[model samples]
Target chain A: MTADRSSGPALAVVGATGAVGSVLLPILSQRADVWGDIRLIASARSAGRVLAVRGEEAEVLALTEDAFEGFGPGDVVIFLTPPEISAQWAPVVTTRGAVAVDQSAAFREDPEVPLVVPEVNAHAVRIRPRGIVAGPDCVTAAMIAAVGALHAEYALADLGVSSYQAASAAGRAGSEALRRQLSLVAGTDLGEKPGDVRRAVGEDTGPFAGPLALNVLPWSGELREGGWSSHELAVRAETRRILELPDLPVAVTCVQVPVLAGHSLTVRARFENRVDAAHAREILEGAPGVVLVDDPAAGEFPTPADAAGTDPAWVGRVRASLDDDHALEFFVCADNLRKGAALNATQISELIAGESA
Target chain B: MTADRSSGPALAVVGATGAVGSVLLPILSQRADVWGDIRLIASARSAGRVLAVRGEEAEVLALTEDAFEGFGPGDVVIFLTPPEISAQWAPVVTTRGAVAVDQSAAFREDPEVPLVVPEVNAHAVRIRPRGIVAGPDCVTAAMIAAVGALHAEYALADLGVSSYQAASAAGRAGSEALRRQLSLVAGTDLGEKPGDVRRAVGEDTGPFAGPLALNVLPWSGELREGGWSSHELAVRAETRRILELPDLPVAVTCVQVPVLAGHSLTVRARFENRVDAAHAREILEGAPGVVLVDDPAAGEFPTPADAAGTDPAWVGRVRASLDDDHALEFFVCADNLRKGAALNATQISELIAGESA
Candidate 1:
């Protein structure tokens, strides 16, 4: 059955019950009405459930071969599912003639599948040979908008990033686990001694390596080669691809903090030319999708708590490196479920929609 | 009124009522007995208080010009006081012929004073021209052991560090503020929105620039010239001085996390020689004052909670940088009060006492 094309192209959101998808639904409703029909698709478990989108209740559809029967050409299907799921189904969605804008790591490293950060490399989306546009992971997505803006003005040469990632970056399970762990540790002095927190949070670490309630875990994704976590390498690869600096000399350390939402990153970037802090601040002040909240003297700087539920990546603690005139250091935070995943995917879909127009 | 030096040299601990002092008293009792009298000195407010040391209760003495009267040569006075207090009283203690081992930033940069990390620069304590031995700040003290160990093997060329500093790094008030804030926000689901945390923690941020509960503040210490925090520059300066590398390139970003005790750092170090992850792990495992807790596959890496109350700096997540053969990245954690402050001070004092013996 062909969906009506008179209104606009149809939009299908896979994994609609997941963390990123939950944020994406509200974002789509809140943003411009560019889609003809918003289709919510999730696992069979969540299929019969009704969710609110664009302030209207919509019944979720189950994932199957027929899910994308009528999603063709101008229609955009966004997969906020796990990598294996996206890898298996993204090709199916694209085979049906719809462009799949995947927010999974599966296609991000695929050269033919353009990794898009709309503000940074929206132009790359037009040349997706695999008919799939991949979005950077939450850590990279949280800071890329600001990093890209700075790179534009200063010509970024080398990048070093350390992330304070939110539990939600691991999906709903991670957030729920953190909440559970917090309840177990709240109003207690569990963090004072060795293994005390672990003893209190016995065997319920959820998606993390250990109890993340009163502690910061340095390990993020699966351990990759050379002891780097997959998430760390993804940040490096995604940043390189998005900024078109394949050999940008990027080093990243991904750590999971106890935060429930926003992902924060401390970025150290070396530029080809001498960088001025004031000029960089001015550039960030005017940059799209970047907010400069950097008045340290007045107690103003981006914290995950302040940046959560926000769309733009909040940048602060801006300073030129003391040892290198060409380097700049700053802290940035953005809601992992929003700008870090949902909004970036939404923006890419909008770009594709505009292309069809 | 000279202390009986028959048992050993007299030891004075100023700021005995403060955070670091609270930890120091326990350390003195636990370590091998090396002193005749363990003097507890604090402000007049805590002058009447008694604290335990070497299995006995010791009366706290008020800070005065005469507090050092009985403390002469062969005696060591350890200052865990604020910089201003140390600056005001260290000379007095030294004038009476006692060696003053200060854990404040006041004398750290003094040309006549030697900044010592006993494990790294124990010999430097022998040449204290000002009769003052300065200890590095908590953040620097926490990671220098591991960094110094690695440098000894590879000859470090450049350093980049991002800290997950604990609340206690600011002092007892910072920890109290975090506990109070945590009680306010715990189990209430408050971190999902912007300023909700700030609203819940109104005017109760204590020593921090903003709410540290469920948030990470990128700024620590006083804002310095060129947009650097005093704490960040201190890490750079202290690391350089302790390593005896005056021209080493170092960059640091100090951030306050909600963890109550231990401080964590993600480090990127470039060495003159090529680094191997397995070999680095072997080196760290055998290095003095360093504990290797790596092995991400088994869910064993250093987290603040696990490292809290420990004397050794826990090093983990060892990996040679994929891009640079000479660079290595790792995460390290240490109790900010113990290894980061109290223990380091005690170790320096031990060295000073050994000098007289």
Candidate 2:
């Protein structure tokens, strides 16, 4: 049943030494069915590092235009670097007939690129005219994948999102660094100064900009001019794009909770098309990569603590939202590393194998 | 400073065996200068129990007519039982010629019963129509205490609220049970049937009614015919009441995060009056019990971790909500056990002391 390895697309991974790439290496290396000759690429600091790819040591190569010189045409390349780095070099890879599956923000909004979540909208992967497959932001990907499953049964008109995101989305440094500030906040010697929350503000100055250990922080990222944070704006735009709601009215407040991994969202979606709770449940039950963990009667739900290492976006708390006939409320959780980033990037690569290579 | 102890009002606390009672017990007893004489009452289960009150071991008495023998007219009572129990016994406590500070759903909607959060509407406590100072729901007290402080600076037209609550709000049994289920969900072995969130649905059923340890349950209670959960409806109604916005439209989603204490809210208040981020920060700085933790340059914010054992509602993320002109978004975290319930109930008693008993 083994296919000829020479006929498959050669896979190249960018940013192999970084946060998500550390997990990506294991997943990509183990996924030999879709990858031909795998290449591990990182920066100068990690140039000589070796990763276990398909149980063999794959030497990490520095990311450069010259690095792709020996690779054949129509190869599949996965980029986990920053948007600027991926944007600057993605074109070079694509120009040489490589299908670029990006985990960065580079090609997501580009009209020519198709930001695809294979579980939600796999059909979009087929129309990547620029040889680039963009992965949605982790929160956006986790949400759209869950709600999209519900949309199959009903049409959503208004979207209200409240995100409980972990510090991890800011990357390994931000989340890990938060561990200190959070512990500090939690361990604050309130000692009967009436231990007000504002005092924690006076105690903390680094990493999280505030304390994060045991508290819930509603403010995340810098406040944009219009009051939205970078995270909030990304959610609104990315959701609109993925749901194909060009001018959809979406309201979102993205908060940074004290969780260590995964992102959880409290969403109330109103659809123009009416579908009762039972029908909606049936749709989610049949949806791909959607784990319906919503048995509220017993207090079952989908939280980051539960979704940390899981591949699917764990969705629950599904029921009606408001008094409106069209609205539905649900909670969604996904391991930002897996479904939000690495797993999605890997899923897009399968499409790259089907398309360019 | 030593006033005649018998000169003040004789106070009684019903449902003193509950979580809120557990916290209020020490606050009321140890700090009785704000009060006169204190009596601890509970259900038959806790009747014989001896709890430390006012630095003395007070005998817990069952809530019977005989308990009201010495405490005659012009005394005070605080009911901390469930609504079903409170509704049945509130009138009884009030009829005993005492001001009843009730912490139940009993009289929240009753026009005669003043829903009170001492910070926002402590003056409202002065006019207990039916001799009952209604302690608001924990959700309302925490939000209104914070938002009411903000409301003084600006007139809000509408509000968007998202609550990150703990299981303790459901009761001590509910909280302890959610903890047990979470342990099971995390430690349980979900074998080949992994992708399905319910690898073993009935394997671990605790007080949460489902697996709640690592999950976010969106429906805090049963979804009524109209769709909103009991928690959601109560939050919305309580917000409207506490803010004195009978017509103020609030779209709310109550999501239960797996945190043990503190209820955090991500709120977007759309004001009728013009307000800016800087002005809001400036206003909140001087607002009672509010501490400005907004410093985006350093990634600082107020979190539940920081708000854990604090007495005040911690507010941060004071910015706008998307493109709405009237909208301002913020994060609020306060110790659910303290500010959300017990501390609030204790604060209400302070108002009782201000009166001639």
Best by TM-score: 1
Give the alpha carbon lDDT tens digit for every residue of B34-123 in model 1. Answer: 898778889999998988888899888899876676788889999998889999999898888899999988988887899998888888
lDDT of 2 by residue, B1-357 (tens): 111247577777888888888877776645546556678888987898998887878789888877665665557778888888777777786776677777887788888888888778778887767887777777666677667866887887767778887667777875566545433333233211223333433445344544444344455666555445676777778777777888776767777665556787877786878778778878778777566776655565666656666677777767664445566778787777777777777778777767664
lDDT (Cα, tens digit) per residue for candidate 1, span A111-185: 899998888888898998989998888889988989999999989999999999888888889888888888888
DockQ score of the complex predicted as candidate 2: 0.27
User: Please, what is the whole-model Cα lDDT of each candidate in the order they appear?
Assistant: 0.89, 0.71
lDDT of 2 by residue, A140-165 (tens): 88788768877666877767788887
Interface Cα root-mean-square deviation for all models: 1.0, 5.9
Kindly give the stretch of ten consecutive residues in candidate 2 chain A with the minimal lDDT sum.
Answer: A186-195
Cand. 2 Cα-lDDT: 0.71
TM (chain A) per model: 0.98, 0.91
Clash totals, every prediction: 0, 21
Listed in order, each prediction's TM-score against the native is 0.98, 0.82
Off by over 4 Å in 1: none
